[model samples]
Target: MSNERLLIIDDDVALCNLLSDYLGHEGYRVEASHSAEAALQRLADDDVWDLLILDIQMPGASGLELLQQLRPRLRTPVIMLTGRGDEIDRILGLEMGADDYLGKPCNPRELLARVRAVLRRAGPDAVVEPRLFPEQVIERSGLRLDPGLREVSVDGEALELTSAEFNVLAYLMQNAGRVMSKEQLTELVLHRKLTAYDRALDVHVSRVRQKLAPLVGDGVELIKTIRGQGYQFVKGSA
Candidate 1:
């Protein structure tokens, strides 16, 4: 694990140092930058980073701005840090390509856990054994999915998908033409039991819908919402 490099970008020098020391102790080669400029320089150097810890509020360039620029070039899994209890910031971060978001004054252990989870999901090593969907590429209603590569395309164009978004698409593809309830999707796709009124699945579904917007208005709704039930994949097309 020590071989895996993590970059910490935050203007809070004390917090950055503390995180570097702690994450280093936990078997990660951690690097810290007090400004977005330094962070970009480190990123441009082509150093292989397994994960990124980015703070939302910074002096020169905001973390969100850096993330917007980095998304096009960086593939490192990012866990964003927002101000204390800023729910809107957290949600915005996730929508802006962050793998996860943590509030300020966070627990170190919890942050470490989130880092491990994001790495596991984003890493190629996440899928160890042969998967049923391995090497399987499915195309239905102009929705193209390649599970082996964790990619989805609409109308032959690549779609930007978060890990959860990809999981939702994969689940729908696997159960093409079958309606799946939110509970089932939350459990099966997310690998966790669903609690009452958990709307994360809905949020991810909306994101996927945005990615598949090009397929809309073509008599082929890739995902069909069943009024009382959940969603079903419209099978048999591109």
Candidate 2:
């Protein structure tokens, strides 16, 4: 039995109870909070969690708000639970540093798969190729990723990249000048295949761009959108 610590934050009591029971049976030590605010207080403690299943629609301080407040400090992987067809919330949650999002009314098994995927991404070998080792720190265009430490930095200043974001950057840097399609990124980074109208990859790329812009300054396009293709990390920095 796995001993991963899991936290679920949502207002629906029945939903919470259902997931808690299901996840608990799966061998995870699970805890539930009825509101985002209450979750925030609980999260402030020293008990670090392995993953968080956060619902975007919550009373008093939405999931997005809590995510925003926790960023760069609370680096625990987050998998948001969004209402079906809630595209905006999904994208917002990604921008807020969430590792991934799933449509609500979800099945326990599917949620378990998602949880495993996110946790796998958090590991050192997030991808299949090139392999990741303790001494293997990828460096490109002033950006650095230490797989052993699971840390990324730009120009010597550390970047607070979530697991998803770090995987994106690491893969792009490893294959600079190559146009990596959304499908490829989705599969390699998120440990899932891309679906139609899946803006999750785009939103993550956008967030990476936003975080890198200020550090690298203007006119330096490290990651470029390939327009109808995908994205590429420039072979040479400006």
Candidate 3:
């Protein structure tokens, strides 16, 4: 079975069907919604979606508007579709954290190609950009994180973390200063729901903090709790 799922939201019925057929043929499990309301409903049901194909212009809520509403709540990469070839819309879309943008009346092959590229880029298993540190390193403060090796450090040493811990840390570190809600973080990092009694994330966070206690010093707090919100990393200055 294919490892990827795609959701396409567009007002054009033919375009949606065509995309659904083409992407399904390309070995992806695909779902399509013709309106923003339907799309939101689909997303809210908390199914796993690898990517979102969103149309900028629509009847109820615009694609850009939907993206604005969803970006903080979801981490699925979006490829926005715009009817007008406006540079402004393109820039705005990218600024709002869209993975890519395309104008309509484009070739189906081209759209498919863009979708493939975006999916590959967004996939966690896909090749990531080079980082400064080794794959795994344990520093004195219990901060064990190997960006390259995708490892974790603790208390000036290394910790054996599961896949979920690593992914949660990676997601938090990527948005170090931002206070992400539990729902938002769950959606963005796990791309899935936070199940009942799933204190897995909280447990991981506690472990990470404990590991780094030694290095935290007096003023250095790696992860800070935001009241009623989520967590944020207080990055230390050199």
RMSD of each: 7.3, 8.1, 15.0
Superpose all Cα atoms of candidate 1 onto the true structure and report the RMSD in Å to 1 decimal. Answer: 7.3
lDDT (tens digit, per residue) of candidate 1 on 7-39 = 999998899888888888999988898888889
For candidate 3, write residues 1-238 as lDDT tens digits: 4658889999999988888887788788888899998998989896589899898889999887677657434667898888766777776666455888788876778888898788777767853322311233333234556554656655445666544455566666665567767766654444445777777567767876665565556666778888778888665431
Off by over 4 Å in 3: 1-3, 126-238
TM-score of model 1 vs. true structure:
0.55
Best by lDDT: 2
Candidate 2 versus the native: TM-score? Answer: 0.55
Task: Give the number of the best model, judged by TM-score.
Answer: 2
- 110-206 per-residue lDDT for model 2 (tens digits): 9999998888887656544333122367788888877656688888998988656866887788778989888887765654568988898888889
TM-scores, one per candidate? 0.55, 0.55, 0.53
lDDT score, residue 66, model 2? 81
Each candidate's lDDT (Cα)? 0.77, 0.81, 0.70
